[model samples]
Target: MSDLKKQATSMHKAAAGLRAVGHRTAKPLQEFKAQSHDLSALGALGSLLSATSEIREGMTTLTKLTRQLEEEWEAEAKLIGEVSDAFDLLDVLIAAKAQAEKG
Candidate 1:
């Protein structure tokens, strides 16, 4: 082969080899990108789980508070009923006393 032709062929082969190396290098980058995407999905899933946990905790606290308020309401209603009955008894006693004095 002519010297110039052999030199050009050698340069071409080197360039082809470099392109192959570049392609090989790109494989890891692509894998890294895929892994990064999966990590992002995992992060999003973790955030969703955290949000759900917070909501569950809030619901539990609300349920407990509601039960406490219901108990307080029941107690207040019972006290009001007892006070009303006591007042009724006082009225009857007053009427009896007045009728007895009218004799």
Candidate 2:
């Protein structure tokens, strides 16, 4: 419920979406690359293949980064949950101290 937790969760979801996109597009891109071989007669075939290779590499990098982001976000969320628990404990302690003083 805390702001930090929300941010962390959002980050995790975003990373997952990025990862999904990377995965989903990969097969199609590879298929396109394979199909491209049939177009060898075209003067621009070399350039097209080169561009496709670049895109595939970029997607690979993006997927890697997304995985890393997911890990970081998960860790951050756990830390935020711990901090939130600590704050709750602190509140309880403060209340108990007040009660003791009054008693």
Candidate 3:
């Protein structure tokens, strides 16, 4: 396999792993949000809840970006395969040209 193809495969795997982690975190974040409402009555707890909400939003955005990256990496892997195929075809043509010259 070409270097580009290998790199694409690595990137795709990493993105997929990160996406899975994001999904795992999402459930906990939802639960936290649900439980946090009870603590809203406390004085300083309001600030804590606000910060947690912001963090949750940021996590949600990051998860979405991770999913998008995973899709992009998958597409990149396919493109790399196409490039490898093109290189193989070029190699065959070059070999044929050399053979014809020898004849």
TM-scores, all candidates, are 0.52, 0.55, 0.53
RMSD of each: 42.5, 7.1, 6.4
lDDT of each: 0.54, 0.60, 0.61
**Top-scoring candidate (TM-score):** 2
lDDT of 2 by residue, 1-103 (tens): 5454555556555545544554566676566555544544444765666765555566666656655765666566556555656655666676788899999
Question: TM-score ranking from best to worst?
Answer: 2, 3, 1
Steric clash count of candidate 3 = 0
**C-alpha lDDT (0 to 100) for residue 101 of candidate 3:** 100
Candidate 2 residue 44 Cα shift, in angstroms, is: 6.6
Ranking of all candidate structures by their lDDT, best first? 3, 2, 1
Off by over 4 Å in 2: 1-49
Candidate 1: where is the Cα deviation over 4 Å?
Answer: 1-49
The per-residue C-alpha lDDT of model 1 at residue 77 equals 51
Task: Write one digit per residue (lDDT tens) for candidate 3, span 1-103.
Answer: 5454455556556545644664666686566555555444445764766675665566567656756765675666566565656656666676788899999
Model 3 TM-score, 2 decimals: 0.53
Scored against the true structure, residue 43 in model 3 reaches a CA lDDT of 55
